[model samples]
Target chain A: MALFATCLTDTFYPDTARAVVRLLERLGCTVDFPLGQTCCGQMHFNTGYREQAKPLAQRYAGVFAGYHAVVVPSGSCAGMVREFHPGLVGASPATTMTYELTEFLVDVLGVTDVGAYFPHRVTYHPTCHSLRMLGVGDRPLTLLRAVRGLDLVELPFAETCCGFGGTFAVKNAETSTAMLADKMRCVLDTGAEVVTAGDNSCLMHIGGGLSRVRAGVRPVHLAEILASTEEEPWAAIR
Target chain B: MGSNPVTWLGTPPFPKAAHAALGDSQLRANLRKATGTIRAKRAEAVAELSDWERLRRAGEAIKDDVLSRLDTYLERLERAVTERGGVVHWARDAAEANDTVLRLTREAGADEVVKVKSMATQEIGLNEALAAGGVHAIETDLAELIVQLGHDRPSHILVPAIHRNRAEIRDIFRRQMPSAPPWLSDKPVALTEAARRHLRRKFLSAKVAISGANFAVADTGSIVVVESEGNGRMCLTLPRTLITVMGLEKIVPTWRDLEVFLQLLPRSSTAERMNPYTSVWTGVTPGDGPQRFHLVLLDNGRTNALADPVGRQALRCIRCSACLNVCPVYERTGGQAYGSVYPGPIGAILAPQLVGDMHDAQAASLPYASSLCGACYEVCPVRINIPEVLVHLRAQATAAKGSRGPEALGMAAAGWVFADPKRYEAAQRAGSLARFLARDGWITRLPFPGSRWTASRDVPAPPAESFRMWWRRTRG
Candidate 1:
């Protein structure tokens, strides 16, 4: 498997990439990174910029053309591809079905545990695109259930926006902060040690709320959770 | 941005103060007091009805059924209205619709036209259009009058000038329109009396009136206009000639559908089980009501919106503005930012669809205007699931243009690696090597789309140790 290690994992949270890779390898699969890959153009595409986003999409289409299946860890980025591909092509085409990770695990690969184990109190934040866009109902949760010693609690208003749209916070700061305050309250209400979600945008927002108040809550990516296994020496192999 | 007249709804001019009152604080207070009170009342009133959910379901189902056969429903509405001695005119777009209304007013031989608070009129810039046609359209509703005299736009649907406070309104009434009585104070009673006197003469003498409909029952050919002020009743019935420009989506299957709407609209809108005035008329009455009636069922890109299955449900919106009141965005920008007469949550989803699926930039900007908070969905009298529609529209809009950016590149790259286990594992090795990139476990300054993320909030630095590294060391 070639890695699309999303820009967030590659540039900021590479450890999530390492976990995702080891989790996959523990399940007996090879991972590869297409070094030429870059960021998904969803940011520019969403902010009412059409002309600025085309070449990045073209670069993506050209670089990953023949791959059997492409998997994205972040639902928002995957949404930009699986959902926005036709928009990228500017026309409906016969070809366009890339998979987000949960989609890959459940639909293509048909596996839950990547030989992972984790012992901790964890709560999952159903990222916007992952829940509504990808419709990954319980796939990540199904994987979470497989881990040994996992204590998972449900977050309240689990469907609400964490108020971290790419530019929404900066553009509408007060409203964004107001929404974030509500989301953090919910995350804290669950009394879980860490918050987990597939999309980084949401985690970043929730984390900010937790950090701003120096609240005892932290957010973890789904990839980081999946990479935890007691049997496999994952990090050394990576 | 404000002058384009093509701006998406809820695109206010002010930033809502990173913590300030407003470049338009008057607008904010007006909206806050109005929306807050309405939202609370709506909750209370809706709670009184155990069947509210069922009613919402019924409304959704009826709207869905009507929209699926929009052509048929519209044709039926047009035919029924025309057969009853009312003239039925088809407007292809706003310009045509404006032209038709102006021509009708001209033919009526009326110099000034009285108006009810109609979104359709504001939707097409009817007052502005009437002015161009050399017609002075007098807004009789106190709020509408405030907006008119103040040279501002209507912010909220139910309360057109909800963006103004009493003092601001008093200032407008005192200065903008000379006809306003000098002693008129901004007190509710004084303002209402002053407006009544100023508009009473216009209502009794005006030969023509222009309005919009809240619901147009196709089966009975009845049109309903709900308002707090009795001005709609006067504008609707007093004039000899009456013209109503109703959107294609405003029709219900039958008068029985009114049972759900009459209950839902007011309480959901003003948080009252019933508003003060509700004017329902089928056609001209022999001795009472307007003698000459014209119903203009305007399409103007609605059919285009109805073509998208996932998006078509947005048409189910009853314009109750329940979604708007509970909406955080609408709570801040106060309808001006939307740049459209429609603002808030409903505007975010509806404007993109109504303006032809974001072929233009303003429409494209509309979808990004929401937090997908789902509060809009929870408060939607019809259960529109606005956030779902927003995501769907965002997809259609992007698909319409075809995007090529770091976001797309990122999805495709991630998509390929996650496809194979070996490659995913190898990528994990690279991940450990790249952990240094995120400093102190957080990445503050970002680039491009990611920068769009860091612009408002701080990104938590990556953990000093990967979960994988920690797990491997502790267990293995």
Candidate 2:
């Protein structure tokens, strides 16, 4: 299987990509990182540049064509490749073979318990794309619950959007902030140490706000938590 | 009567208007409370049916059939209405519709007309037009009365005054309503009683009444208006001359088709099994209802929407406002910021298409108003894929701006970079230089376009080495 490290993860959140590699290897799967993959053109397609997105969609298909399976850690990126790619460049092997991390784990591998340990109070925020687009219901939570020591708490209004929305966070910054404020309040209300989600883009927005207010809460990726074990604990790099 | 001329004209683009609305804590609180309440109720109401999904499919299929052969259905409806002793008028746009209504009201020899709360009339700015022509159109619906009395634009579709709390409503009534008793309190029943007293005289005295149709049955030529308040029944029955301005898309093929919508609309909208009042009328009866009836069939940009294959689904909207209630953006910014009678996710897609002018900056901005959360799509009774239409309209808005715009240029540059792996890697390497700006591992400020992001949220500094660089170094 090949790893489709999305642009956002490849750049700012490289640890997440590395953790995916670690987790997959631990599960006895040989994960190949395709060097030619850059982006899935989600930012372009969603922000109204479909014409610009076409070439990138074609490029994504080209790079990941021969892989047995392509795993994307971000639900939105996987959703973009599967849902919009067909419309942009027609359906290709890349569109069909791609799976979000949780979907790949629970459905493809048939493994919910990855034999991981993360002893912390964690609340899972189901990102909009993951919840609605991919319909990845309870898969991530199912995985989180199986972790040796992780305490999974339910987030209030968990299905609601964290309002990152790629360019939407910047274009409609005020409304985006208002949405983020409610999200942060919900995260704070949960009294959990960390707020985790399947997508890094939403986490970035939520984390950015949590960091700004010095809320003392961490926004961690689901992959990073799953990658952690007793022998090799996942350290907070920052 | 007290509201200013209803016009979306001169309204700022969505971001600007939403910025102003976000500053109002009261509006935000009101919106959150009202929408939140309805959101839960709608869920419970919808859950009562086991075949809700199947019902949605049926509603979608029915509306799709209506939209596909709208001309035939409309002509059949016109014939049926005419046969039932109703005059039928076709309006190419808002001006024509407003003019026909004015002429019809004048011919009735009436200076005042009572109105059922109607989005079609609101869209055409009928009251303002009537007021200009020296006719008074009294809003009979409770929320409409509150909006009319307060001189306020409706911020919601089903609940126009959702932005106003009971206190604010009482204040508006006291300030603008002459019939409002001084002792009128902010209690819900008291407010309703005061409005009832105010509109009672108008219902009794007005010779003409105007309404917007929820559904127009092609086979029976019957118009349906579902409301919580019985005000719609009063407006439909009491007046001698009745004028109903209906959007061209509000047609159901047969009387049986209403069974699908009647089941879907009330549950999705007001969270009720059945609305309190559902007024359906054919044309006219001798002394039973209105002596004379006129049905103004309004095209008014609806055809522009119907032309687009993806956007035509917006026509399936029953004006339930379920999309508004579930929308995170609408819950925060309220409906006024949309600057259209249709607001929320539905408005974001519908307004831009209806306006059909992507060059209009305000209409162009509506497509970008949503976060593309897909919550609205999940809750829609007719299964309108609002997120799909929103993205499609965004493409139209971008294409209209041409290739020379800054955003377009940026997109082109990014596309060029992403199309080739080497260029993308080089760009990633260059992006790592931003690590110099990091404070405690986060970039708090950025320049130009990135500045928009950094204004409210902190961006993580690019890692010293990207994931590919690490992979090649360690594994290659």
**After superposition, which runs of candidate 1 have C-alpha atoms over 4 Å from their true positions?**
A1-161, A165-178, A181-203, A209-238, B1-33, B179-185, B405-440, B464-476
Candidate 1, residue A9: the lDDT equals 59
Best by lDDT: 2
Tell me each candidate's i-RMS in Å: 6.9, 0.8
lDDT score for candidate 1 against the true structure: 0.74
Alpha carbon lDDT at B131, candidate 1: 91
Q: List the residue pairs that clash in candidate 2.
A: none
Every candidate's TM-score, chain A alone: 0.92, 0.98
The CA lDDT of each predicted structure is 0.74, 0.91
After superposing candidate 2 on the true structure, give the runs of residues whose Cα lies further than 4 Å from its correct spot: A236-238, B1-7
Predicted candidate 2 versus true structure: per-residue lDDT over A30-146, tens digit per residue: 999988888999999999999888888998999999988999999999999999999999999989999999999999999999998899999999999999999999999999999
Considering the two chains of model 1, state its CAPRI-style docking category: incorrect
Clashes of each: 61, 0
